[model samples]
Target: METALTLQRTRSLRWRWLWLTPPVLFAALIAGTAIGETSISMDTVLKVLANQLLGADYAVDRIDAGIIWNYRLSRAIVAASCGAGLALAGVVLQALLRNPLADPYLMGISAGASTGAVGVTVAGIGAGAFSLSAGAFAGAGLAFGLVVLLAQAAGGGSCNGRSAQASGAIILAGIAGSQLFNALTAFIIARSASAEQARSIMFWLLGNLSGVRWDDVVLAVPVSLAGLLVCLWHRRALDVFTFGADSAASMGIAVRPVRGILIACVALVTAVMVSMVGAIGFVGLVIPHAMRFIVGSRHTRLVPASALAGAVFLIGSDILSRILVPGQVLPIGVITSLIGAPTFALIMIRGMRAR
Candidate 1:
């Protein structure tokens, strides 16, 4: 009865907290843009947004309008999407592998994605009017397939029956593949015959939101939405897996096939995101970990909470990117790595101590 009461209380709390998420996330995103050197008041920011959104289409000022619309707003959305995608991927990978440390990039997805993006940028894969996102998508697809194949090889073909040892082996293979892809990417960067080509490759690899448009948002939204739905639908299965494969199987879960499909879906979603935004890192790594404390590991709660947390984190980070230096903006990826790496290290150290 006490346990039941506790669960009820917890659910109540989550229900209340969930209501605050959207406003807080949206506020943070808008506020992040208001902090730069040409700092606009929140009132002005809101007004500009209201006017533009309400189809007034009149600039409070040309400068404020440009800063608010052309630059900061788009960047915020990109950051939020990247964050949400990464965190969702992280949760999916962790659950699929049944390991706290598993991430989408753990299986060399990023490296493969990077290779494809870099190859296109350097090799000039598209003709005039072609898009870099196409190459990025192709790269992400190839890399994702390779990781699954390598994991299967490590897992003795079925790859469905996951053991700690199998998980470890899969991780190692991913690392190796990532390293190989990174080396090739470096070679492409080095052999670039022109400064422009080299610069483009470097910027893309570094990750940025400089030229983001409605089109980028359009491409990313459907894929991200689909992936989120998949994650949510499989949440119960993920919770079951935490208990063990046998336990999950006993509960009628088809562990292997579900995991494979989830992984593929996450990869496809992530590949599209990376193709669009370059390789933004660590939102996945950080957000899910943080949300787990609030929501526990129940997929129903975890999936939505993690998505919100991720969106919050990345939007905040992107806002920081623009305002961090006057007249200079850093890549969203760099901000995430800078903030995420230290947080990750702390999580690692804490885990080691607990062990």
Candidate 2:
């Protein structure tokens, strides 16, 4: 049944049409850059992009150039980077844990980041992007460490070797960690914040890219690129996990250490992204799963497809968020959830039918 489904999906996703992804991404970026409180046309967007990015001689107005280059350009880049990073993290976690439902946030990383960002937001500690980012990264690390510690206590880590038992332990640990940290976060909010601050925290937690700038884009680019390279490097190891840990070990892969490394990498990349984008959902959870159906189960194909598709998906969502309501920018996360939830349902329906 799985084989038949794979074949069917593969036939539908022609290799030639795959070239459309780049152009689609470019178009989405252009559209996202142009659509805002001050609407710029596609031509001006392109002209600004060319002058700034390619050192072209095309003329552009200063106001439009500032808006496009400083604000929207960075926002668009960060959106695409965050989307790709989140999707990569999701793919890694799903492959490592052998669970289709796995996503970057399942291990309480998002909750931890929420706690950290809230703490910063409410603490009056410079409430800047860097401060919130620092807090979130620290919190994510804490959550990740706790999950790993508990998994080890339950003898679930692949420290010695990989086993189904270990994966179950990690998942259980993650659940426990999530509940505990979530409660802690609520406690922090209740104890430390006024109603307004709490409300602001909630909004931020839902994910807002409004404050994103070129600084964010600069920060995200290296991490996203590094994470993608790491995933690509280990794609073969990920592919063999479908056959089980022992099978992978027989093929000369160190399943346990590799798992640890990949999980850590995914967790950090995810934490960094959530720090910038606030806990945007669905891109990570849905894009990889959908891309898998299109590209087949091979990690090599899956990773690149997920990266590009995820980038396009988030950039497109950012555009929708702007246009969804005039003058009032909706949180990008909300838009993604609206789109993702439906796609997720559709995927489930198709999966069930296949089964």
Candidate 3:
């Protein structure tokens, strides 16, 4: 009877988390919108959102309203979307590959994006026609394509059996692809970019949200939702993947097709994010591992927990970037690394101790 009561109580708490998460996420978004260079109050933030979103008449200051609605709100939304997408991608990759260290960038999408952006900016490949985002997206696709081909050539596609071999092949292929694209980016930067161009490219490569707008919000939110839906749809498969691919196949999972679809989804989501905001690392890598600690290993619980945690983490990181230094906004990536690196180390230590 006591055991039954404990189990029921535990389930009740889990359900409470589900009920509480959305409100917490909303509050985090509001907090992100309110805290910035000018320190707009939460009351004003809510008034601005109500005025714009619900067409309510709130006599907020014009400048504050413009800053809230036009700049900070949109930025917050995109940050949330990117964070959720990247975290979801990480969860998928880690599950599929059965590697705790696996992340969205494991497929070389970020490297390809950097290469593409540099090719457009420094090599003049687009001749003033292509935007940096376009170039980055194209580069990401090209790089992922090459990585897929390399993985196939190295026997990653033979999912009739030998799932572990296929996973290893893909990881190796991704590493090679990343090295190649990163070299290409560096070469382009070295060969043609002047100091100013190099500085701009470097700044962008480190990640920037200074340029995000409603248009980006449109792209990010839909892609993030789509990615989350796709991952959640495959949550069962992902849970199975935690075992070896052979174990998943033995359980009647179509290991090859499922792997391909999920990986392609991850690549698409990562490419879109990299194009929009440059490569922000560690959110994907750290957030999933951290969520696993809190939510356990079930994909049903793990996936959304990771997404929410990731969104809030990035929003908080963006906030810190804005205010960490007087009169200067750091690259969001720098702030994440500063936080993620130490947190990751602690996680590793905990894992080692647990083992």
Worst 10 residues of 2 by lDDT: 10-19
Model 1: ten consecutive residues of lowest lDDT: 154-163
Q: What is the lDDT of residue 152 in candidate 1?
A: 78
lDDT for 345 in candidate 1 is 86
TM-score of each: 0.89, 0.86, 0.89
Off by over 4 Å in 3: 1-5, 121-134, 145-176, 192-194
lDDT of 2 by residue, 1-355 (tens): 9999987666666453356677888887877788877878989988988897689988778988999999998999898899899999888887877767667566677777776766676664444655766787778878878987898988787423366677777777877887787787788888889998777666766788888888898889888999999999999998987667787889999877887788778877877888787888777789988987777788878888888888989988988888889878888889999999999999999999999
Residue-wise C-alpha lDDT for candidate 3, range 80-168, written one tens digit per residue: 99899989988998887776777756667778877887798789997999987678778877987797689888767632224667777
Clashes of 1: 1
Cα RMSD, model 2:
3.9
Choose 1 or 2, whichever is better by TM-score. Answer: 1
lDDT string, candidate 1, 1-355, tens digits: 9999998999888777667888988887887667665778887788788887886654488788888877777767766777778889999877766667677666677777777777776766565334566676677667666765877777633334357776676667767777778787888778763787777667766677777777777777677778889998888998887766787899998877887778777777777777777777777777788787677778898888888788889887877787787798787788888998999888778768878
* Candidate 3 lowest-lDDT run of ten: 155-164
Using lDDT as the measure, the top candidate is 3
